[model samples]
Target: MIIFLRRKMSRSKECLMKYNSKKALLVTGERKLKNTSEKLFSELKVSPFYLNQLSEVLPFLSRENVDIIIFGSDTYQTQKETFSELLQTVSLNYPQSESIILARENDVPFVVSVLKFGSTHYIKYPVGIKELQSLMKSAMATQPAISPRLEKEPGKDSSRFGLIMGKSTKMQQVYAQMRHAAMTDIPVLLIGETGTGKDLAAQTIHQQSERSAQEYLPVNLGSLPNELVASELFGHEKGSFTGATHQHIGVFERATEGTVFLDEIDSVDEKVQISLLRLLEQKKFNRLGGKKTIKTDARIIAASNENLEELLRKGQFRQDLYYRLDVFRITMPPLREKIEDIPMLIEDFLTRFNKLFNKKVKKLDPECLEVLQAYNWPGNVRELKNIIQRAVLLAEGDRLYIHNLPPRLQKTRRSAHSISFRIGTPLDQIEKEVIKETLALTHNNRTQAAKLLGITRRALYNKLNKHKLK
Candidate 1:
């Protein structure tokens, strides 16, 4: 009987061991991604530990047999090298474990490039909870039997690339174009408003392309002086001009085998345009005051806030040069066009600033978010980021209140007088009226109206019927 009891105990221990080995995941990020990931984890019935840095949870990773890892883009901040180091270490220590990176769509290419250095996959953020759950399950089921070779050599620094952050359908279309552009060596022209992240899009394409290993050099044509534009782009020979005290290599030469991003390309003078056109066609150019024709194999990616075609019509920009750079074109949409993405962006920026300023802001008050949604972001994503950062710094408590926002934003807040009402307005009638108004403003889109109401689709539908407006 004692022998039988010993065998039963052994069987029970084995079952407990197997149970302990099953791990869902751990999500590391600042506040934004942490909250999102937590919601996803809860919906999927998976437990996730949130940490600002990998180092803080290094013991957990070492002790727990985590099945999957979800890392946020904020892990790559200037001061935090631990995340990258942890990625390398995790690959070496737990070769069989599956790792996935979560990042904004614009940063997907950059994140993928970096994670690929460690043989990992990257997932774009603001991902649906169901989609995330599906991805995690798929990852677990298809765990690679063998480890892939690390592409990046040790001791080599990966080039810094720009990031684009949005998950809305409109932004998804832009992402598709970017990915298609990344597959080739074509010259791309990106036209967008000042704060729409034209530079970021250019960098993302370069990072996702075959030339990602090469250098990426950016030159702001608008910032250059006419007298110095040629010298800066084509370099200068010793004693070539007044300030030519030493030999210099231009952006084209420096960016060989990579990409040269010319911002405000419309600002280049006619002479510079001719030079640029020649380089684009012949891939060859001469230094200032030098006879030697140097060859460069750099991919050109140019951006402009102005309408190049209109500029061409007005004789401000060259028609031929415009065609040369327009082999592939991607236009970034203004923030107002994709307002549904504002919540995701706000969350991302909050997490970023939370880490930067070492604050633990928990949430943005519903009224504050409502005010933000109502206002038009004329400056696009950049302006939104700046505003959120400022608000976080000035915020008093855990939650970000409307009064904590800038004067401009506070002034835009809805006043009591602005609230709509009728003498016999029922609660349900009021809800339907608000929904109808929002839907009309959103062009009869239920999803957008639901977002504005801060409720799920089912909730919106239920409310629509309760008011007999279905």
Candidate 2:
């Protein structure tokens, strides 16, 4: 009993040693930032130390084994040369503390410069807790002294490691979730509006999964006839149905040792949902007419544009199957939800279409882009891809003009608004106003406004109601 007690105490000590809170130092000139920093660092469970100036940073850094140093842009920009010298001095003297620059959204060029000079990732302003945690976890969890401090080269592959190109926060969250989901064979349900690239996400998941080398079959439940849905999904024997002339392989059986993406799974009848429940629960299913049981190791990735919960309430979907597929569900933002990625998506689609049609359309008319940004995308990325393809094919000059687009695309004129900050404005009020203005700019489009504000739609909704900004 004493031996067991000793072993338990040793284990507890080891855990306590591993649980050492990371130390972080914030060097900023403003007192207001201290409160915000305190809240953030407290949430992260880090030991935070503060200094008013960069000059005082070195002494503290050399004494305390600080894991990271955050330099506020407001102060860093004031004395760029001095701060740069301080960072260089620390790099030479301390050789351990990872340096990070706090930046407002507009400081991209400055951010690029500092990144080259050996600072870590920029923690953008209006730093939500999640973004801070994501960035800091990525920074603090790694070798604080060794990793390269620069972003990757621009000429990355089209789908960079199964990631569709867009550095927008919304897309980044999706990428993070997808990457997390890919590491497991547990069922993943992709919830997104139609044409928001749910299938693309599913394909990426399959490609990134352990089953990458095997077949990936995507069956559209919405397109399949109600009568043939079962036979199509679970296979059929010869003479099983009026048109069943030969034994057939189903998607589930064919996708053994691989993945089967069920697009528009929300549309499947309750009967199909029952079959799905068994497949999800047991990983086993029988053919439509055969007696023999078939087992599969195939991963199921179900996607639905509609709300599955609403369907459950309406008796249109199975609650059991819904819960089963909801294991690691990721919500895909609509194109309008990530309108900031419009240009990136356009560039990708334009390059492909230009090569396909042998057209050299170089750029989009600036006004045309504005029209696109202002318009709400009902059909999402698929719609935008089609528009870009048609524009590339029809565009005769180096630029894609508004006239080349359909009448609906050419319409929608929203008065653009500018967002600016006053010195004495409360940060909370500033945030509220920014949300309100972005909504107005998007013409009351919460999705587009959320994209513009670098926040989730749900977060935007909460803030809107919180601030009572209609």
Candidate 3:
């Protein structure tokens, strides 16, 4: 039995108990080991839930706010494969959890295996009660504190993730994936239609990643000339080619220890794809002219508007290269698919362009809002942003009216959705008509009508009562 001297603990029992209450899971198939560890923790006034099997560990980890994971060396020796998988999952998804391997003095084999799994804390048997207490404190100290901003609801001011903004279910999924991508340096491939914010997603991942402090270089591969793509990516030696007047450092070299955003990755020709595959595999490449193999620690994040899977089938994109880049895929949803986010997006854009153009365009006219929401945004967020910028620039008054939008968008305005009013009409009468039209549009579904009209359900009810349109 491990002895625990409560009076000798460096920290107070209350503090240790506070941390323990957050939860810890102790896994071991040996009943003796489980009982000993439990007694040790109990003496320190900490209680850890016990699991006998590695299979149970993952499910519990997923469902609970596990701060520390202590597994016996016996468990590791018997279930090496499962232990390794669990370590990987914990490292990637639940990064805040500290994994400690409990081993005996003679467990040299276990020590070797643990090293391959990365930095994991371990305690040998016959550990002093003070040492065990210290280890627990150290493990708890390593766990990162959750940011207050992240704890807020997604639709609140916290809706923005990096530069990308949306609270739609699809966008929330994207944000989660982006966070996962940022947690590692694995190659990320963003697939989406044009204007779906793939570029922004790549930038956001880099911004949120460990590599944020390093250079973030974005290259639009499709914008470069076919012959110049290689030289642009891998640099060129002086006089290497016709235009290589001086030695030029490429993205991979310049962004060493940083992130490289390869926008329009599908446009890369066969030759560039070969170079990319080699770079992804080896993280080393020779410049366009130089033969010296330069090693780089650059993280690759490639984005494509076109379907690369189809390109792979058509032999346009190399299969091996596709596989290498497809490690962490983030598919950005098109604007039309996330239509409910339009109002919020519009509000964001309005705030942005309002500052840029020195205009205070307060709100979109009811018809203008309806037209924008109804149109199939083929150009996605980028198109909407451009239209908003134009509208803000052309907006003559506080409200953004239909005439401020492009004629193409004007055509989308439905007659039934539009309300006509005389110049001298009372503001209250106009408000009543607008509410009546919105109710009809939503078939009297107050919740949705409130959303469309950009008001709380309570506020809409108040309006209905005031207008006698309830």
Q: Pick the candidate with the highest TM-score.
A: 3
- Cα lDDT listed for each candidate: 0.72, 0.74, 0.78
In terms of TM-score, how similar is model 2 to the real structure?
0.62
TM-score of each: 0.59, 0.62, 0.63
Off by over 4 Å in 3: 1-158, 418-470
Worst 10 residues of 2 by lDDT: 1-10
- lDDT tens per residue, model 3, 101-173: 7767677555546544433677777566577767877766544443222222323443678899997767867
Tens digit per residue, CA lDDT, model 1, 1-470: 00000000111223333443435555555676666777777766666655566666556655555656777666665433566666765654454456777777676555655554333666677666666667776655544332112122233222212378776656756765665566567888998998999989988888876678899988998998899989888898999999789998998888878999999998888999999999999999999989999999999999999988889889998889989999888999988767778888888888999999888887898888877776667788889889999989987778899888888878765452145697888886777678887765545657656877789879989988777775
lDDT per residue for candidate 2 within 1-470, as digits (tens), equals 00000000111223323534578888887787778878889888889998887778766654565667877777776687786667655543344456777777677566656564433557676566577667766566442222111111234322343646666667766765665566567889999888888888899888766578899999998898998899989999998889999999999999999999999888788788899999888999999789999999888999988888888898888777888999887998877766778898899898899999999988898878888887788898889999999998899988998888888876664443456787999989998888877776677988777766778789998998889888
- RMSD of each candidate? 17.3, 13.7, 13.5
Q: How many residue pairs clash in all the candidates, one count each?
A: 1, 0, 0
Off by over 4 Å in 1: 1-162, 416-418, 423-470
- Sort by TM-score, best first: 3, 2, 1
Which model is ahead, 1 or 3, in terms of TM-score? Answer: 3
Best by lDDT: 3
lDDT accuracy of residue 136 in candidate 2: 68
For model 2, the superposed segments whose C-alpha errors exceed 4 Å read 1-163, 414-441, 446-470
